[model samples]
Target chain A: MTHFEPISPLSVLDPRDRGGPVQPLLTIQGLKKYFHSAGNSWFGAQSVVRAVDDISFVIHKGETLGVVGESGCGKSTTARLLMHLIKPDQGEIIFDGEKVGIDIPLTEFRRQVQMVFQDSYASLNPRLTIEDTISFGPRIHGMYESKARLISHDLLARVGLDPSRFAGRYPHELSGGQRQRINIARALAFNPRLLILDEAVSALDKSVEAQVLNLLQDLKEDFGLTYLFISHDLNVVRYMVDRVMVMYLGSIAEIGDGETVFSTPVHPYTKALLASMPSMDPDQPTREAPLSGDPPNPINPPSGCRFHPRCIMAEAACSQKRPALETTRHKKSMAACLLQNRDTPIPFPPIKVSGQ
Target chain B: MTPNQALETQPVIARSPGYWHGVIKRFSRNHVAMGALIVILGLILMAVFAAYIAPADPIKGSMLRRLKPIGTPGFPLGADELGRDMLSRLIYGARLSLLMGLSPVPIAFVIGSLLGITAGYVGGLTNSLIMRTIDVFYAFPSVLLAVALSGALGAGLTNALISITLVFIPPITRVAESVTTQVRGLDYIDAARASGASSYTIIRVHILGNVLGPIFVYATGLVSVSMILASGLSFLGLGVRPPDPEWGLMLNTLRTAIYTQPLVAALPGAMIFLTSIAFNIVADGLRGAMDVKS
Candidate 1:
């Protein structure tokens, strides 16, 4: 058997050199994705679907950065862009001093980054055995030698499955939770620096989702891993992430520490998202105001602020110019709303901290 | 374990063996498909052992045996126009007919799959060029195209095979292209790309693995059509020449003996029908077996 020396130049560089103290492990600057639909007679005009429009975020080492939004807000597209699953039309992805881009080799990129997909049932190859699916990454990257069975068993055990019993089984034979665990195990087998969980537990039942979330927390602690967790479920994001970024219509509306954002959301859209969640305490009063209208068509988003049509606190400036994400009164927190501006003494919505 | 206990646990033990096992089990339940598979396999075996199975030399003839009726004591299926033993010649004819039928399918499949996969996966100019080329060939009817190609290539078994293979390439390419296109859109292929798998690796590992099963089943179905076409070419004297015991050529030679022994003339036609039917059955079975949705 021929063995090649591990020849990755990026691995030898010190991660701290890329950013200052408290610098992010992964920094995505100005990420954008525009999907052009083929022009046809039925649809008179050809348009670009601005899926992930100039979104930016930083993922600190050993912390989970949760990206939350309703569907079509480009949360999934952001994850894909960061992972380089599809090339971003314009952006720079810097991972640990290495300038990561579309041209980076997948085998080397796979060693540092991995993704756990949304649908556990479809994520795994139905044709492969459970062991084979789990071992695919390690085998492909040449991480394990000839003792594939032993490595597969170790991975299966790490994911809390009995390798002796379940290793030979196929994906359809396993339950949804089990398949998801196998998927996670497959990603972890490569010892990746960053793991992107793209609604990893969304498809599982409530109890199974909790279990998987717990498992994820444990795995992160054990491996000292960074995560880009994309989810629509606010409850799960609160439990799993250190910081939360709210996306609306392919742009970040607000970003801050999880507790700060949950307790006192600055953006109207963020507040609306939190307010919509069903409260557990019967004694607690609910916000009566409901967010009106569906998300704007991504093909032709509203002019100026994309959320102005849906936002309750829209002003004259909101309709004319886009609100850039600027820092507010809270240190290290930002909101993309004219209301957050010092010059604008705009009356804000009453701060409602229901469950806290 | 007791027999009852063992029986009870069988379903649990079986679980899901894998995707391929599921496909096989689904295929087995289709009776019409299974019968076709058996017939195809039987024809293949007959073709492979044609030399040992044939009772006499296919080309040799004697005046005494000429015009002998089928089911006669000495010559069970009687003799052809030249007095060649009908049973011996029919058995020998299996070799040429099956070869002519089966050989062109793989050639067409390889050419078509490459073209189709490229066109479907890589959109824009490359796709447009390959698809338009395929359309040009598809514009002509398959039989007419094959006949023209054979005439251009000049008459021979190999030339006829080449012509028929060309005739089938467009349809096979279309099937392969569509399947590959669908497979390319799957999430796993994107996952593979994210993992830093090269374009070649993505195509070979992720795309081809998913698409091949459907393409293979389609190719198997085309085998029967290729065989019949090959036989037709032979009957027209553009394929296997005289003295070579081919089913189509046998029909042509025995056409004159129809008045004297109608049953003997029917023998070659019966062989062609049985062989073609067997192939079609097997192809149907494979289609049922490989269908993931079923």
Candidate 2:
């Protein structure tokens, strides 16, 4: 495997290398959200779109976990579910050692976890000024208006926008990148522990995207934040995330440290995804499509392994037997592929039931 | 990062006006809307100062001078079937006419926004319940429904207003609901929800401004329809009593003189047509001005 120097300097002191066992900041288990297709009559069983089906993953403390997938692969759905923007069909989300909605009330859980969405303008309340938008969370949580304003101005400056100039402006008055900076500032209003960035920088121009990514990196370290970064940009994922999770049809195909997953993908689906990244080098040109055909209709995904139909390494068994996430040869990663050869057979840990 | 730092040092651009300020500025630039607004405001001022503005008493009329032609010496607009000065009565009629035209709208706007926004923001069962109930009100034509409601309630200003208010609520509610639904799905609302904002707070701070503008514009369009409906009710004898100088009632009492003095007889109808048109064009202007994109 060709080793690429880690883009982020913080990767040198891996969270896994801490003295004790690495802590899981957020644990999701068996998360499912099925949307009922429109035009279904009220009487009978409706056609269900299984947006996120039985997905489980862990976001370790102070680490950025990038989730990548094609459109409708349920990356966005998973982000929404984690934030409880849309309630999951069946699942448990444990945040910072507390059961969300039970041990920690939803309101309290929300204060510790905030989200910055993909649409910079749509994600902001257009009617509110930048100051109002940033202070909105603090005011909602009962902080005095004056104090909230002060904190918002401070945050506005920290996000690299001059508070004096931008704080009074409305969303429409600002550019896409500036609006995103305001969104980031607002997310930090609660001093949130985890930030769910759902394609947060995808809409910006390439130059602005780099600046915003750097700002996010600085803010993540400064706030000691764990990020659930959802993006389809492989180059960005490699640069911004410490760990990478590859999703296909609402299931995790492979997950490992960014360098390992990018350089040596075990799952055929993950390999296809990495190869799909557009090459900048003139000497090495992509000769063929990495994966053929669009993802199967999510309404009735293929039985057993969701990726079996398109997976190049699929076997007869792959079509019949579902593959659970299992440890791969590399100690730092796991792959959910029937053909992945296992020697030590370190079984993947089962998700703990809610109460336990 | 370097570019962003440069952006920070750049002086602030000229401050953009607030949303409503922009709306008002756009509204002022529309000549047709401004003209309509002036006409409506003039009529309102005439109504407010009716006692001073009217040339002669609207109630006392001589039988000998009844059904006089337009441009009569004493009565500039002529005399109605009751020989009442047409201009004086029309001037005085503005009070009740504008009241009937304007009052029902705000009442319906408030009530409909509450119902529609509630049904929209709290979706599923609550949405189905409220919207389905509103659909029941839409089964009958608005005119027939208003007349029937006025007939059932007994004819009076209050009852007529109530009936007109009822006729407008369903359309306004439907508009409010759809707009609220649209705004509710916006990412900002989701962001607010994720920020631990209570549903009430989301509806108020985040959802209200977005949805209310469209709903208000829709309700303004309803005002013209309300005016015509109220006039129809009065013409049907289910609104203002005979002696009142309301435009609709005046039209009813003057129907007998249509053949003898058609010009005089058409004056009240003319007033109704003009006022409704004024209201409609102003509403169109508001819609244009408030088109968030512009």
- Candidate topping TM-score: 2
For residues A210-234, could you state the per-residue lDDT of candidate 2 as single tens digits? 9999999998876667799999999
Candidate 1 wrong stretches, greater than 4 Å: A1-21, A39-45, A101-107, A147-149, A279-289, A341-356, B1-35, B55-57, B60-69, B72-75, B78-84, B120-124, B253-263, B291-294
Model-by-model DockQ, in order: 0.25, 0.55
Q: How many backbone clashes does candidate 1 have?
A: 4
**Can you list the residue pairs that collide in candidate 1?**
A106-B195, A106-B196, B36-B281, B36-B282
Count of clashes, each model:
4, 0
Backbone clashes, candidate 2: 0
Across B36-125, the per-residue lDDT of candidate 2 in tens digits comes to: 999999999999999998989988988889888988898899988877888999999999989999999999999999999998899888
Whole-model Cα lDDT of every candidate shown, in order: 0.81, 0.86
TM-score versus the correct structure, for each prediction: 0.86, 0.92
Q: Which ten-residue region of model 2 chain B has the weakest summed lDDT? A: B7-16
lDDT string for model 1 (A86-121, tens) is 788998887765677444544566678889999886
